[model samples]
Target: MRPVYAISGGVSKFAKSRPDKNYQALVKEAYDYAIKDLEISFPAFTEIVDGSVASYFSDHFSRQLMAAIMAQDYLGLCPKPSHRVEGGGATGGLCFQEAWKSIASGHMEVAAAYGFETMSHVETWKGNEFIALASDVSFDYPVGGFYSGYYAMMVTRHMKEYGTTVEDMAHVSVKNHINAFHNPYAQKRNRYTIQDVRDAPMVAWPLTRLDICVMSDGAAATILASEEGIEKLEKAGAKIPRPLVKVTGIGRGTDAMRMADRPHVDFETFIKDYATDQEKESQETMKYYQKLWDQGTRYPGVHSFRAGRTAGNMAYRHAGIHDPLDELDFVELHDAYTSSEIQTYEDLGLCRYGEGGPFAASGKAFLPGIDYGLKLPDKPVCPVNPSGGLIACGHPVGATGLMQAVFAIWQLQGSIEKHFNDDTLQVKDAQKGAIHSHAGTGTYVTVSILEKE
Candidate 1:
């Protein structure tokens, strides 16, 4: 397969209601921003670009189908090969990888990946109800399996199984929101105390409004190309960044939509299958795992995301990441909720299982040079959600993952100060990072490795 590089990326300002722009206009706004960053005219880009992949979570939000074609028309990539991609909240992540495939497979040398969502058309409650339909309607949905309740149940189980506390989860909220406070594109950029998070109105027990991501009307676009494609752009006066962000690896995972249908493996098999040689030999690690198993714990009961683990493992192996905590400089993951952020720390191998709670409070996932006002045990090791993640930036479904990709690219290029106009969220001397996207109650997940080249 050919190597793929992310040439540039852009995002529209994220907000609960972008009343001034329609979905297509939002996409155009992002696309124009990307081209402008590249120092290329949109018309010139139309002539050089090969095709595009449109990403959006649902047609229900727009009340329109084949939304991609409309966006295609708006972007003036008429008659170019194009298609649509969707997978719940992973829509943007999947779209990104799909564009990578297009370039790597020799199908298209230069591909445009864009995602958008106009979720403000419906009332917040109605929008949530529509989102709840992503669950198994035949089983999970009939029982009122909206995301808030489902995520709340999962986090409660996490608390029971791993001693994850509300305080621990609140730290994630505090950290991400503080990180977002510096991000100009983020929706909820206000700084908050841990108590502020806990004091917010409860959506579900122990889960507050401050803990969840808000729906937004926004869009994001990324320009991807092969080696030759990069040269083509350079010849066309595109001021591409040095040490381009390359797509080093990509992985996706899925599980049964119905949580009841999810299966679990026994402890011994689980360890043999999952534990590393070092972990298998560590007496302390073995004892800790054993204690959990002995306490009637199962591998990836609703408390954890098996799909996320699978995706992270695959991407890590593909990228040759042996220790994510030590190797990657940062991670912009789908933090739709604070609890999920902690859960993902374990899933992504930043820490051992059952230690996600402590990881949340450790400051290891925090960006350097930020004053979070919370006492932490460790300095920043691998800063997760440095872009404030979905919890801060707002989740526009399809736009969320692409937004992560854009931020990862920016961080790799050391352009956060230029883009965000605030150097606080920037990771200094960064080399490699990742973007993670998740959908529904762990039904679909995507992880991609991005590195400066």
Candidate 2:
């Protein structure tokens, strides 16, 4: 019932890695960009909400969430209310949720939420160990099982049941890489062919190096205000952007922390069973048709907890969207792997449960020749990852959630430049757009839908 609003949002360029800047410096750079990008002066907001997943990794009380504290210091609001939120990869989105609730409840009139993580500063061996440990201890970590292994199990199962092939998996990476080619902020812009993906070095069995999202350093921020606070800011010197991308809904859900702990009848099992069905259909259909629907088949044993779909579904419910496949316009989802994007299409109801691969090949998801132009079957299901996701944009765990929020807001505001447009292109503010995030290996999910007034 409480209406939440965003006045401005911004993000630092997403890179595969940045060794030049330390954690604090990286956050400072992102905060400055957010402030200037929004055209807000130093004295704009009175409260700050910060978050980070790796502050524990950075130093005692030094994760990325410290960005709020850092921003307050930079803004010289030394005594303003500021706090941290920690939800592993979902930290940023949760931070935005908390700030929105604060304003909606009349606790804070104006607030700023910012997040960033410099994962490159940490050693990969230690980081991998830590991430692996975040899963269930007795079942997942004792033997050194990690996300790669866990997802590999799922992929294998899917292949066994669905009869999907490795070629199907290759298409996922190829689709996302081609989309990323137009994004200047993307970490890796090199285009990949289906053959290239098929030939790429395998990371776990079916999944290849290109299938994974690159770990990197980056930050993002958003400023929010209640209607009354906006009036006051405008009365003073701040130039709050008109027509706020208001947060209409927020929803979150949690699954078994580790797949090994998941009940045999749980959603994880359901997805695997579904993948198996897909394989059977592909095998049966491939004999008669060149493509299952329009694409090749994939191999199973690569199941991933799609946090974005779960979160996005919740946000859609709160925002009153019952038919996401038809009603929504564009999306920014966590593409931790190429398969993630394809799976999310099914999970989010954008495509039939196992038809996601064919959906990608339909030339209907994205506008042809336009980079980042993923669409719905007809109009372009609100362009997907227009800014490039973790696959193209680097994955900075603690900062990912907030980065999603920032990117969604930017897309809605038309602040992001479309790479190619000979004609005067105008995207009317999206009536409904969603941000999806996941944390702890898809163990946690959060979705938020934003709309224009």
Candidate 3:
């Protein structure tokens, strides 16, 4: 895969809102940023793929629905085979996959993939509904099941079963926010404490506003080229960028949309055995509280766990990584919520089941030199989500996955260190990194591994 496709250049910038720029302008901004540092021509790209969701939310958004074609004209990359790829929040990852396939199959020499989303134009409720549309409409949507609520249920169960305290979850938010302070593109850069996270307004029980990712408007783009394409450009007297990172492995998977369809241990037994002090209340009070507990204990989406595990397994197999905690240098996973990040640690094989909370709370997940109380891992088990992930950097749905890829490419290229001088924020001499994205209520999951060439 390294010899087949290389990420030559990439760009990503995000904000809470971009009232001045629409979807096209955002895409153009990222495209320009990506190409500005490279000596590449528009004609050199044989294919173009656009990854966007909710384009209608942009101020001057297109009604044509042909986002890829519209983007080609906007960027002046005319006559090339251009198309749009979408897999809910993993839209950008799918675009990258398509670009890789095009070049790997010998159908194209060089391809460009870009993703954007303009979500701030609409009201918050409307935006929430739009995101909820990605879930199973027949089952999940009708029951008022949004992402936060689904994740809240998962975290609640994790806490009840594994003794994961609220403080453990708050630590995840704290660590990511600390990392975000170093990222210029992050939506929220303010440092926070466990008390602040605990005091924030609750969006869903056990999940506060600060615990979830903010909706944002942003864009990202990446240019991928084959070895033959690089040689062709060089032979034609074109200057090519040196030290491009290669795509070493990629894996994708999907799971059932209905949460109940997934295989999971019956958490009811755990709840019964580990009943909290609430059980000591009066009989009437206990009955009412038990009713509430019963309502909240339903398995939300075990598919999320299964999907991530499946994808990670395939990626590890392809990359020949038997022990992710030992082999990988860093990770940029889908931290849509802090709980998701904790769960991902277990799912991605970074730690054992029921141990993700302790692993994260222990400060092992934080980069080196950051004093967060607990001692860092004896050997750092891949600093997770150093980009602040979707939690603080914002989740623009369509653009999130590509942003992860861009971060990995920069990290592997050793270019991230140039932007931040902090040793904790830098992953020096990083030869391998992995990026993961999950979308559509766990209906789609993608894991991509990159290596420095």
Candidate 4:
């Protein structure tokens, strides 16, 4: 276990291209924003964590060894202990976990974590190759080289075992896109329809182009300080809130990294341990889905069900979330694909397993009407991705986790603008939000519950 620390940080807008500058420029932009906006000084960094998806892209985009050193040299904070680590796709969120741990363990007073990626320089196929290399080369290379196909394998298994629908996945996409529309920094503001998704050509059978998160080129950075540092700041007349975004928990686990090599038959089985029922449609939908499973083709594969939920569960338990959907105010999810978000909501205890679609259909998320006195309905519906998730925000690979962290901080700080302008207040006393992110096909899932207090 690691002691918790405060996140006093900022990040850059996730985008498809930083045409005006190179990789270092992009890094500098993120760093400068984090420093200036959050009032952090470069010399305050006692440790650093550098995160990127692939070495090939790191070379092409950043053109530097040890991203921490690159950051330190650029900011002239060298000689402070720094290194780099990569956990397949879990790189960015895990890097934040690492920095938080260092500060919590009394190893460092102040730490800096950065995630940068420029996938535009490289062809799409090459990026796929980089992801493939993360798997067992011998097992994965023999099969077809499609990245989406690998996740599609899980989707097929999920559909077969639980009767999850392509429509359900499409619903996730539509919801995320709608949420992203309000996000000024999101790369894709285009709204999508379920019919549009159904009509679009399938990238993988049962999965369409709309189901996938687009390749993005962006960077994000954060500055973390230990309790001592926080106390020092307060003593120096700098105001800092208590219990501010602490890293209450952290965990790491891995299953079959490759899709084909997985032995699991049912996707939901991955999360059976923490499964719960949705009061609304649990029995009927589960039975209907099972009926579909009995009729459909079964292609059992390794899904992120356990890994993703495990990460969230750890964070939730540590953060003392007795009831997530009600206790949590909002979420910035890892919408790498449409299904990822819906399934993640369930995994995070926001809704019952297999009832995410119906829950989403209820239109409880981000309700249309607003009244300051109008309390949330009987069933609490936490807002998802008010910041536009990876699907719309542009999946800048490693920067996503940091992007989410910054968004969480912003929401907690009351800096976020409501999606719709209402004459009157909507939810009473709204202040906190959650941040959820995953790396590489759900190999790593991180959930942080942030509060204003």
Top lDDT model = 1
User: Model 1: runs farther than 4 Å from truth?
Assistant: 275-284
The models' CA-based lDDT, in order, is: 0.91, 0.63, 0.71, 0.62
| Error in Å for residue 448 of model 1 | 0.3
The most accurate candidate by TM-score is: 1
TM-score of the candidate numbered 3?
0.85
| Candidate 4: C-alpha lDDT | 0.62
Off by over 4 Å in 4: 1-3, 40-68, 234-243, 260-304, 364-380, 418-432
Candidate 2 residue 209 Cα shift, in angstroms, is 0.8
lDDT of 3 by residue, 1-453 (tens): 335545544545688789787777888887776665455554443233222122112222233466656666787766556777778777777777777777766777767777787777777887888778777899889999788888888788778755677777888898888888888878988788888899999889888888988988888877777887767656654564457688877888787777767654345542342222223234754464355445553332451376777788777777777777778899998888888888888778787556678887776677776655444445455788888888889988777888888888778877776534444577878888999988755668888888876
lDDT of 1 by residue, 109-226 (tens): 8999999999999999999999999998888888788999999999999999888999999999999999999999999888999999999999998899999999999999999999
RMSD of 4: 5.4
Per-candidate count of clashing residue pairs (backbone under 3 Å): 0, 37, 0, 3
TM-score against truth, every candidate: 0.98, 0.81, 0.85, 0.81
Give lDDT tens digits, candidate 2, residues 1-453: 456688776666777566676655666566666666655565443333222112212332234434556655664556666677777666777777877887888877767777766666557766666667667888768887887766666667655544546666665566567666666656787777767876778888888888778777777777777788677666655665556778888877667676655443333344444332332345554342334323433322134344444565566667787777557667677777666666676666666555666665555455344543233244344456655577777777767777777766766666656322221122345566777776665677777888776
